[model samples]
Target: MSVSRCDIPLPENFRPEDILAFHRRDGERLAEQVDDHGLKKGLLWRGLPSCLELRFQPGAARLSLAIDGAAAADDAGRLASLGRRMLGLDQPVEAFERQYGAHPQLGRLIAARPGLRVPQTAFPFEALAWAITGQQISVQAAVSIRRRMLQLCDCRHSSGLLCHPDAARLAGLDADQLGQAGFSHAKSRAILALSRDAAAGALPLDAWLDGVPVEEISERLLAVPGIGPWTVSYALLRGYGWLDGSLHGDVAVRRAMQMTLGLPDKVSQPQAQRWLQDFSPWRALVAAHLWALLQAGGF
Candidate 1:
């Protein structure tokens, strides 16, 4: 496959390294390689396995991009769109800062990391799959299972990088197949059902990106078995960049909140919900900041 190349303009003062650091947090991930300078990951574009390499152009406000294995002639436009979404170039960080910069609890966090932006999955289904894989497990354990799933799918680019399995591929799997990847029975059932729905076009994961009502989307996602507030919120955040999904049910968010607020005990889900309500409209962003605070040992 021929390599397709392009240069994507970066937002002013945008630190691509921040995004790289987030991707590298759990150590080297399968299907992807992350370094101090860039990320190289395999993606399924129109069900075609392709390797995308993004390198930051030092001292320049642009990213040098190369896609190996994409065949479309007009891949540049697709590349730019993917770059903007994956890099969060379109996130309204300034608006978030203006609204919450002086927040008593989050003020310091915002000041500390003004360039923070939520990195999104290349596709919504990947986010949904990740949310299901990560349920009730430590991040490291989830990463292990995800790696196994990728290996089981056996989708790879010519360069031998694993590609994240798309819905059709996942929908074809039985519980036993996923069990080998360490998915519990309940999670396997959930993933299979969701994938089948997605592959059948019953679930419009892509359409939801087009200004769907958050409540409506949340309701639809909740109707799926084994999916709850946390999974839906996480999928929306990473999949749609929807920022206010009430992530109070998240254990890490609660732990971060407890420490950030100087509480001796972790706050209950309901309590965290009430406290996060004050942040409204940006609750997930607040959660991101709290996670950053926890990561930085500011608590």
Candidate 2:
């Protein structure tokens, strides 16, 4: 197996654990996908022919990134880019804390985990596929299904680490085929349809959707079979690193907001949307940190 290693520089106040926390929050093994250390995320970089298993660790001023089983000779640049994006290395560490860090609810978690950074996948297609698989289900249930589906269909490197399948591979499967892999009819159709679009180059891939108007991008992705407001917002938040996307419709978002604000019951979607406006520019960070709060037992 070919191995390539690089040290990607980080912005100030970056902590590796802060980003890995998001990966571990579900607590279930994604078909033995995530463990105590690094995990796999798929990427078809510059036509590498197959996905590389990327595992990274954060350090004092840089991330120690390794790509095990990579085939491309010049894949280092792509790996560095993905490392920066996945680790939230571009974020100004103190900006959010400086602005809303002292708030009664948000402050509790922020003060304790000052380095909690919002992490994203290396690309959009995998994030969208995961969002579809995870829609409207309990985290435990969704992860169970994902674990099954990935084990059944995704590509695995020699290390036994699997990468979520690419559009070309997934596009060829029928809904009935995916049904056997723990997908509901709706999710099956969504996955197949999205895969087809992506494989055919009809939908945006990776950073292609970046810098497009949020409304325009939303319209395009919502046109997919299973994408909705929550999925779109969730995808944009992690997929494009856009902090403007709100998690108002997410169950976790509502639950966290309710407990943080001490509300009697779950807030309505409209209420959640309006309430999230309080965090406005940092809504995506707010959502990640709120989810982190649950993992940290703050709520």
Candidate 3:
């Protein structure tokens, strides 16, 4: 195995642990790759097959690669690119703090957390499958199923790391096959539909949209069987890295908002939207902070 290394810089208020908390809600997340040190390692892509070990420093981020041979050498570039994208290496941390650091409610969170950035998946389909499978289920349960599904697809990286299932492989399968892997019938069909569209290049990934309204993107995604507002906002928030979205529809988000805001009952979806309006252009950040806060028992 050949090894290579790359370093990515951390922006102001960078908190590596916060990103880990957001991405790794449970220790057993099948699609997530984080070690005890918070270092993450996984394949560049299912096809590329190289494994990248990601470590973060206070001032910079480091990537270590283990490649099979010359065949996987070119994939190093792609590894770095994905690393940059997934880690939000270029996210404007101070800029957001400067904007919302003084807000009465969110300011407390900003002051408490300091630097928390929204995490994104290395692959869009990973988040898509997560969104659909996780519907009405606990995150821990969804991660468990996600792992079983990847094992069924055999999407392990060449360097011996688990990764999300590839769209092409999933697109060709029947619901029963995925069902055997622990997916609910509805989730299996939904993932299959999404995979089929994505594999056929019919579905649009976040990268395909530039300057597109968040609602418009949400509309396009709704055309898919299991895609919904929560999924769309989640995909945009954690997958696309868009900050102009919300987790209002999510139970955890609702609970977090209620507990934090001292609301007596769960806020309705529309009410959640109205509440999150003030955090426009950076609602995703608030979502990230809320998630991290919950994990930290900030409530």
Q: Residue 7 deviation, candidate 1, in Å? A: 2.2
lDDT computed for candidate 3: 0.71
lDDT values, one for every candidate: 0.81, 0.70, 0.71
- Worst window of 10 by summed lDDT in candidate 2: 60-69
Write out the backbone clash pairs for model 1: none
33-88: candidate 1 lDDT, tens digit per residue: 88777888888877788888888875433433344544677777777777788877
Quickly count the clashes in candidate 3.
0
lDDT of 2 by residue, 20-69 (tens): 55566445443224444565543444433233343544643232333344
* Strongest candidate by TM-score: 1
Please provide the root mean square deviation of candidate 3 (C-alpha atoms, Å). 3.0
Per-residue lDDT, model 3, residue 97, is 90
What's each prediction's TM-score? 0.93, 0.85, 0.87
Steric clash pairs (candidate 3)? none
Range of the 10 consecutive residues with the lowest summed lDDT in candidate 1 = 59-68
Candidate 2 C-alpha error for residue 134, in Å: 0.7
